[model samples]
Target chain A: MSGGLTLVVALPLLAALILILLSRLERRKGAIAGPGFFQRNGVAVGLYLAVAVGFWAFFIIVLPQLAMVDLSFRPKLPPSQMGGPKDIFTLENYRYFLFGSTTSTANWNWLHIKAFFLSIGVSILITLLNLAICYPLAFHMAQSAPVARLRVLLLLLIIPYWVNEILRAFAFRVLLSSGGVVNKLLMGGGLLDAPIDFLGNDVGLYMGLSYAYLLMMIFPLYNAIESLDRNQIEAARDLGAPWWHIHAFVVMPHAKPGIASGCTLVFMLSAGALAAPLVLGGPRTLWFTPIVYDRFYQAFNWPQGAAYALILLFACIVFVLAVLRMFRLSLGEIAR
Target chain B: MAAAVELEGVNVTFGDFVAVRDANLTIEPGEFFSFLGPSGCGKTTLLRTISAFIEPTRGTVRIGGRDMKGIGPNKRPTALIFQNLALFPMMTVAENIGYGLRVRGVPRHERDEKVKNLLIQIALPEHGHKLVSELSGGQRQRVAIARALAVEPSVLLLDEPLSALDLKLRQHMRAELRAIQKRVGITFIYITHDQGEALTMSDRIAVMNAGVIEQVGNGRSVYAEPRTPFVASFVGENNAIRGRITQAANGTATLDTPIGPLTGRNPVGLPAGDEALIFVRPEALKLGGDPPSGFEGEALDVTYEGSITHVTMRVRTGQKITLSLGGGAAGILPQPGDMLKVGFEPQDGLLLARPERS
Candidate 1:
């Protein structure tokens, strides 16, 4: 890969090594009371570090990312001149996507950048909509419902997802089709003069993406709100706080970690989503993932597709950081 | 600004179970009243009824002579300190204390000023900026109390607010709570299963048992003249002897007992031949003393606690009686199997008709 990719992969591993060494030193010096983590777990810290480093940090994450970074930095070569100068390492693909290449008359296309931003925006919008829809539903499920009822509701919510995601997207396409039940009902109710083209617009894709990941948002919120002490709400009420104030001041603050995590999951998943957009989107929709797919499969440009995927990955990380910062939550809290 | 809280025939039922039944009591204005009972005895339910958290199934709850029916907890003129204190962990001490003011739309400057004064009142002025989690158990207890008081409610309700503290801190906070109540001069209705706490802090106490208020009186009255056998047994350690009332007169009844006839003052005045039980406090019973009447027993155990020596003895009737004697009894410590003579004045023992056990 490139030097930047190498550094990115090495940095976290180095930090983990430093932590392990420091903790080991502290144990030998008896500076801390308890046994070191590895000793307490009855295994050497190195073994645990090996499992984390070999299985997770390297093989699962860094290796695949490094391969992609390598592919992204290379230039596209034709089949006839497979090992030609065009195959050399270059930033041409990234440059093309970010600033658009000079044509016969060097004009800014702005298509790729606009698509990138639009997808990010739609992802954020979906995240927010899911939050607004799920918070109350989750709170009711976790706090008010009896155990058996909660289980039944959770089962009902999850049973739909047992079907494949692609199949689910196709189901949405059928449901939102011009001659489908939704349009038929609207027309039957005299709410529409003509059947609207749902799949030909942004609305169908956004709705499908949100529905695909709705459980990802609800479970975290349910787990967090469930753990909150009900007495806090009662105490707030006893202190003269109204319903809105109680939720604003007490409930939301206590659920920050869950909110952060749920938003992160939904944002990341929706931003990188391909199946829903593929099934439900029309010419009007220009999702970033479709562009990446066109580059790799249709146009036969692996380097450019890799670059696009890398950019989307980095954007997802930035979004997660922004969410954590906005909520004043730490990674440790989200990890819980 | 204190208000009298009166519950007239208040009853709380959850589905098929009755939590608080026919609770009738009047808490005088500015009075430090307590509901003392074991777990699930409806003390907390009664407190919640007054706080408007739980509406009574029957009758009316009146605060300051105004009916509080249909009033939500927030709209009611009462604040409750939960058992866990329930201080907002996310908020600073000042913010927790001032939450009520903020909810009432008080200006920031006014809220800050009131929060500052409450911090001093709670003796945590420097810790106002610290989160509730940062405070010690006693500090959290004080903060919860200050938070409840900040709203300037006519009634302050506390539900075992000191139960989480250690023994020393719980004892200390008892005096602190009573002092704060005096300073605020608001009707403080505290709930606790700890009888010692109720006896130490309350102006009057209502001892509840099985969804019923067995007795309501001041600490001294409840301890010295319990009207019911439940009150006499639950309030403190009491030695009881089952007997039949052979002779009933004026206010005293002579009970025919297993260990011979015993005479004591009877407030219930059960007729002759009615089943009765006589109760005597450990402190009221004396050992190694000449008295009007005495019993012979063998000392089974002797425990020395700081200021008192507790002697557990087995009487001729196989009844276990405990005697709490002053430190002076240290010199005359009764060993196991030692012959012991213990007796009490007739007025010290109370005779009550035992209600048939369900």
Candidate 2:
């Protein structure tokens, strides 16, 4: 029965992937048909590449996700009684996410639902914050900065990313703690009478998540803005547009695709983030992923965890679609 | 709102490299002026200084008799059309044309009306609804011009705006741009490396070399009476004879050359024994003339260009001299290796001190 269900879900996904590939190939048919991949790189080498990509896509990505989807719809039965009379397909796991189990006293799982929504809301805030920080920096690097200054700025931005993500998160924790260097400086400088509760209010988490994915936002914005003609900005200025007006009317409109791609990347990554939340989240902060994490490992509720994971994945897909619609951008444009 | 532009000892330098130096000129109100030079000759820099994009390193830029030292480009009453047109690709043609008004907080209906009128003026009435990318090259050029003119600036600065078009379209735009300038009656400061573009469109042309404005005069005067050797060679095609001045009297000088002593008008009053170059246009040199200033050479190449035939000949001293024959005058064309006599009247040639560097 699970095998049948897997096939039903997998076939459409396979068809969609094939259609995308075919359309892309058809668009480049003239160039491809002239020399062709197999002809240019020997047939043996082409086959090897094809087989390797097929193996990675099916086994590493598609099969694992399919297995999780299949698991989410089934009951969590004992190993000895697996696939037996009591082990059947059900929605109890997903229902437990919205309303507590029948035995629970509460009518709804308000804590978990609140956490889920809060996680999404906070991720959005982080994405906006990243955009605000990256846009000007990217614009400066791409348009106004000298080549030497741009090189130095690029090196500074990239060097910090060489550290492991978890280590970076931990470093943020150290910096944001009550007795951290930040608080010490604030106190010594007479800017604060006491250390601010950066970690207790989730400020550290937001800062950590924003810093973690900054490069994701900057590079795309820089790439898009760099392709814009410098004369467009000059023309605007020559036409009596002030600096901010020029950016609002000309530069921002041109960077829409970059903004869309950057927002999607930062939002998706911030929503699914584990290391940053685990290290920098305050005791009061309850993120959705931690709940999903507890179900999978601590509580050993694999079915419920898979169901929650799928729900989060669905929400992310909806967010991506909403962003695309809002920006009036196609996936192909963002891909560029 | 036409205004006179005065640049007094304007100098612009980037660190040690001087882009434009000691430029002093007055552009009369509503005059169509042009800065003509080859690439890297500081014409664009001078235009930028006048437009307030670059502040002159040491001078006063007075627009309408007001000192415009620290004003930004937006604050200045000048509009610039970039070389590439620089139309906003994301905006419709109407929006691109009306962007200046929009920036100034003009009402929507009024801005739309103005944009519509501009579109009609540029002969792009139907293209207002289309994106900039959807228009053809010539349409985009017109849209850029309309965008600049929409601001109704006192001065319009153009930086080789027609360079991207083909020959046919460039010629057409030249007339269209000149008509627009005349109709508006504003100070038009045009910058171009194409001598034809400058000569055909501008009321007066300032020829620049390196960082110096060598000569400023009307097209006829600049071409017929160039004050410097750079202007003489740069303004038109000329056969340059390098020699030493042997005699300087009155307004003419005799140059002792490899072939013979050639005499021409000395506008610069070069003294005897000074190195000099005499330039004579190809059309000035006639065929089979028994003039005192004449040379006999073997024809090396003959190119028939419909209305005119150019005969390239090598003199005995191995110097090449080109003489052009009018369409009907060259009934019997000279072939390769045929001996030809090329001559030009003394008054038709110009002699000036040789430039420090070629």
> Who wins the TM-score comparison?
2
Point out the worst 10-residue segment of candidate 1 chain A by lDDT: A101-110
Q: Residue A172 deviation, candidate 2, in Å?
A: 1.8
Off by over 4 Å in 2: A1-42, A190-193, B1-3
Which portions of model 1 miss their true places by more than 4 Å?
A1-33, A43-49, A79-86, A99-101, A104-106, B1-3, B288-292, B305-307, B327-332
Q: Which candidate is the best by lDDT?
A: 2
CA-lDDT, candidates in order:
0.88, 0.90
Tell me candidate 2's fraction of native contacts, as a decimal between 0 and 1. Answer: 0.87
lDDT of 1 at B299: 94
How close is each model in CA RMSD to the real structure?
A: 3.4, 3.1
TM-score, prediction 1: 0.94
Q: Score the docking of each candidate (DockQ).
A: 0.81, 0.84
Q: Candidate 1 on A149-171: residue-level lDDT in tens?
A: 99899999999999999999888
Tens-place lDDT per residue, model 2, B59-138, is 99999988999999998999999999889999999999999999999999999999999999998888899999999999
